[model samples]
Target: MSTLRVRPSTVLFAILAVGGVAFGTTCVEACLGPGRAAVRLARTARLAERLQLTDLCLFTEARYTRHASQADRHAAFQDHPAALEHFPSGSLMPPSGAANRASP
Candidate 1:
């Protein structure tokens, strides 16, 4: 009968691979339970909305000032009414007299 030979390095590698997979599986299961995942999604969506609001405000301010055109201002205002409602009055507008200065 021929003897079966198992190399030490091969056995060690198999054990490490199995252990790593198990550890990864456990971590994923614990971190991303259905409820936990949903909460994380909700938080991410809210953060995205806040960031989008900031971007819209900045863009509207730039368009309103640079062009000094009422059509562009109206178009930008119509784009994000919800963001406009969120901020206090004059928060997004340039400081008094700032927009009127012509760039050299």
Candidate 2:
């Protein structure tokens, strides 16, 4: 009876080769994925323009923070002027420009 034996180095080399192939595939996808999606993106953009789409909804946690343009400046702090933000999304989005401006 004959038994086939594989060397440790051969196993290591095979593992490394598979990893390198995976990394290369990821790099190729990263580079070309956007280009492939550009057509769909443009079509979506055209549809949005035709429909006069408003600001994109970012968070579903609260109505005030749902859409940036539609957010109320003081809604996040409605509970108290110095109240800590309750919604996780509140920390993610920065105060809108209008909120930072002084009222005349």
The most accurate candidate by lDDT is 2
lDDT, candidates in the order shown: 0.56, 0.83
The alpha-carbon RMSD values of the candidates against the true structure, listed in the order shown, are 15.1, 2.8
Candidate 1 clashing pairs?
Answer: none
lDDT of 1 by residue, 1-104 (tens): 99999999999999999999999999999887877789887887798787763222333334453333332324335557554522243344543343345663
Estimate the overall C-alpha local distance difference test score of candidate 2.
0.83
TM-scores for all candidates: the values are: 0.30, 0.72
Off by over 4 Å in 1: 34-104
lDDT of 1: 0.56
Error of 2 at 10 (Å): 1.7
The TM-score obtained by model 1 is: 0.30
Lowest summed lDDT window (length 10), candidate 1:
66-75
Residue 51 lDDT, candidate 2, scale 0-100: 89
